[model samples]
Target: MTKGGDEQLVGSSSADTAASSTSDVGLVDETKSKGNTTNSTTDPEVDQPEVKKGEVPRGPGPFFYIGGANGAGLVSVYCRSKGWQRIHDNKREDYKLKWCETKSRETYYNFKEGEQLLYQIPNNKVLTTKIGLLSSLREYERVMNKISTNLNPKHVEIPDPKVAAVMNPLVWVKASEKFSQRILKMEDFFPESFRLDIKDEKEAFFELYKDTQIWICKPTCSNQGRGIFLLKNQAAVKSLQARLQSIEEDPVYKKLPYKAPQARVVQRYIQKPLLLEGKKFDVRSYFLIACTVPYVLFFGHGYVRLTCTRYDATSDDLTAHLTNQYMQKKNPLYSQLKEETVWRMERFNSYVNDKFRQAKGLPKDWVFTVFTKRMQQIMMQCFLAVKSKLECKRGYFDLIGCDFLVDENFKVWLLEMNANPALHTNCAVLQDVIPTVVNETLDLVLEIFNKSLKGQRIVPLQTLCHFVLLHNGGA
Candidate 1:
């Protein structure tokens, strides 16, 4: 097992064994003949599909798993564990790639390497690769259509970015400025100063909250606590500004840098954060939705990420200020902490379970049951709002990570909704949960396919039954 935080490599051969089984069966070719000069289809055996000028060819089946390159590996591992054939191969060098069919030993679909394959299994499943975009509306529509067709439903549609902005703008938080604005809007949730739009009038922010002890600055869209700062005084901000300016002048920093500079946000520092043994941390809750049924499910597992140092609202205490994995690893505290006392998801779950159990009025499995139900309600509301606004159908969001900040009051604040949540199964907690999660996700896809087929078959069966009854009665 590899030891990196997110990139931990757990040697699980179940996926490999499953993949081998599917490959041994051989590939089944299901290409339809198009007898025309213009509608030329590539022969899988001889010539690879021409890297065409237009649209890439759709795969023979519906069942795609699109995620980050790291996520792709995890999904592949999970799919192989279940003995399901993965049609798309990222390692293939040929521009034109194909879905391997184990039964017939042939490729079913052909498209360019790194090109997103729109897959649809006739009456069975469909999946597509996730493509990166440079903020193009046409490209967004194309991806939406591909997802809709792959799912085979009109109501299950891709989420519109515009609609998503209204429901959960965290997806667009690509800079610190946006993050600051978002935090300021949450003043009702946080009593601290959450000022925004003060780039030109930075004094307005300071004037309103001059008495505050500490403030944290963050870049809007970055994750894992990058480009975050803790400032105690005007001199601290000035000093940090000088450092940033120095970094800007560095040759290496100048060569590779962020495209935009005005994406930072600042927040009033939390003074008395609830802590375990003086360390600061936060929780990430995993949520899932099945588009067909419009249902939400939460994994009964998540880990607590603890900063390695005791709570501090000072600029010098980097570990105390940032509760992120990257920062935690660097802090000497992580090394000093007892191995049994280290933060882990399963331990957190156990703690929640025990706490709830000990409470007089709380229901058993209250955290799992009640929290999941509320999460579902919130998601349903969000989905309905998006659907009404966007007029889309047949799109499923299989997984999402909802970050939460717990106050002294024990209230949970929805920090953000991660649309494309990372799915690495390397962690011990994730390793156990991931296989089940993948199975459930795939099962939902299969269910939708079966339901569509059943609906189509129902009409003909009912018609035949009515005709047979009439004929027998007349006889």
Candidate 2:
């Protein structure tokens, strides 16, 4: 039917994207420092440094370090390619900045009080958080209320210390409160969820969700598919009784020091999920915040993940319900479902756009429009959930990952927000995308860090990731 329609709408090189998407909150084009950005549309290969035809990238001024082997290999390769050195002991090199998953006193080596990383306040230099705020969002319900009280989008307010905690499944009550306050009311997006603590509470929520078609029980603070299960009805909730009996049998776990909230959130399950080839899918989004409140950069391209097997509500198997990549990869169909397993958002657009437009009710760009708006709202709410407790002095930067589930009606729902998501480029699609974003994110960080050092306003550089100002409270 067509002679020469562009077959590769989404396959352009990262360079093309970097050049075309040079937007910033304020000031000059954030893409390049002078006439350095290349706009020519060459055969798309994510070019190898400046060797591939683009202008030479600026030299990395400060050396960096990576702790906790999460993304060390990839960062090592990047460090070598850019002629940047990675230091082992901070004392061994003039370590300007470093990345680590956990915030320990040991992680702050060689840096004085003012040095930056991700840490709690009272620091002279900006520091990043070690826990759930790789992207630096944690919900201090009390503090959140205060931030909203004196809310000035044009000015930053020093938040007071109010019993602080970052978002996890445990804060459904607070999330519910905020969702109900919104004009459109998205309270239904998040299913009815409640915490089960002390023996008496379990039976209450069990009765609460007793009539729901399905329910899911999740641990308050855990990762990598641990202690998660799906329950279809009252009979299924009864099965948890056996597990609770076991926990009661052993008090050792309760004795562990600095324990996370020993709570479980039971949420009503979405019986009708939007599926691809009958498999449940969820979109993943990422953000990095290295600056003060209201100012953060959003990555433009995030990907989608699909379940290995078709979603079967009746199936007893865990893989059919939980779409966690760490768990889904173990399913035997994971290999056979390679293309169906993960997708670049651009690939998703090319595939879904025309098909979605074939119908008359929804707009052609609904994904970019409605879908994106929903995402931004969720991200902003999440940030507000913990804004007051987050320390955003100089030198503090973080990367965060969020997951969302869309129902059959294309209604997006926030599944969970995570800090310090595993940075290893393990998936096939990740080999190309992960390293590129990591590199670009680092550059943006450097740009800000250098600017902050010289008392200059920080402007975001062109992004492989989209940078959106969720809110802008001037400092």
Candidate 3:
């Protein structure tokens, strides 16, 4: 679809967005009483002995535990700032908050909701995994299509005006017309993707392949641009199929603890991408699911990552096509050109304003306005797609790194969502962004947790920092 089509859809759908926003606030209020039911509810007060107002309520010193090396230092520092002690033991279940890069079932089993906080939902793979996301989007699209079809026009005579108002399809359609118009179509943002592991999806991909088009094959769960390649013709597709078949047929491989990387996906590649200074790049944004029970979600800004080499549609080098920090680091001159590989969103906006604003007839500060809202809407749709299936609790929270690619036409496309996104402060831009992200994340977590525990409001958050609230699901 054209960019104009997307705008029209967004404009029409947005007609009901204001009403939806009002309803969301109403939902929080309506669920507040239900939210304070302790064990059975989302934001129940923990059972604690009453203490005098002047006397400091004391327990276990409000201890916190850090589980992995991803962002341990920053987390520890943040905990210290809150006057919370850090426990080195991973097995302990007494910690008030636990932030781990890797999910642990034991920790979750012992988690004390309403009294503690945990990072990451246990079943986040539904949105994190490549194949998992694709499946969810496809299923959501099918369901939405069915609903739309059922709402189609049908003629029926009614004896009474009130009965007609209640039973007539036109009445129902008029009521939901704006809402139906405001939603995003799955194909509008997500690229055409097929799971190679599924026989039917694989065959469909093969049938859809053409010599003129480029398809990118990727491992479903792998990150850092690993195990990715381009399929330019029939030969590459057949070769990949043979390799997968061989891996599956290898009984010897099955006996081992680790299996071969047979679970893969082939996505239609964006041939003409919006390049910055002639180098391919992608925006790395964030989706924060801060609270699961009465879900609270936010969108945060992130820096852009560019390839080390210039754009080349027919380039044999993968570095030119993949705009990831890990891919860029592999180049021999990376050490000298590292500064050029990353750009802060402000810098990026300035560059675009200077170069393409008038030429493309874009609005002033288009990055902060149009592009930012577009990314948030896409993320909201993705969350709504898998919201019900996600495992939720009072304490569980998650932050997902969402990557997006803009075509030459300025249309945004969601590439993938990554759980436990890279927090390395290796580059100058990262050094400035990652720390703020971590600090603000903790600030919001603590603020909301305290309010929720005290049966207060989760909206009107004071420590939102750079985060924008996307969904306020009652707590």
Estimate the lDDT of model 2: 0.53
lDDT of 3 by residue, 145-238 (tens): 6776556554334678887667857565774576577678878999888888778998888888888999999876667776799998888888
Q: What is the TM-score of each candidate against the true structure?
A: 0.50, 0.69, 0.84
RMSD of 1: 18.0
Clashing pairs in 3: 13-182
- Candidate No. with top lDDT: 3
Worst 10 residues of 3 by lDDT: 8-17
TM-score of 2: 0.69
Weakest ten-residue segment in model 1 by summed lDDT: 125-134
Candidate 3 ranges beyond 4 A from true positions: 1-59, 155-162, 165-170, 252-262
Order of quality (TM-score): 3, 2, 1
- Between candidates 1 and 3, the one scoring higher on TM-score is 3
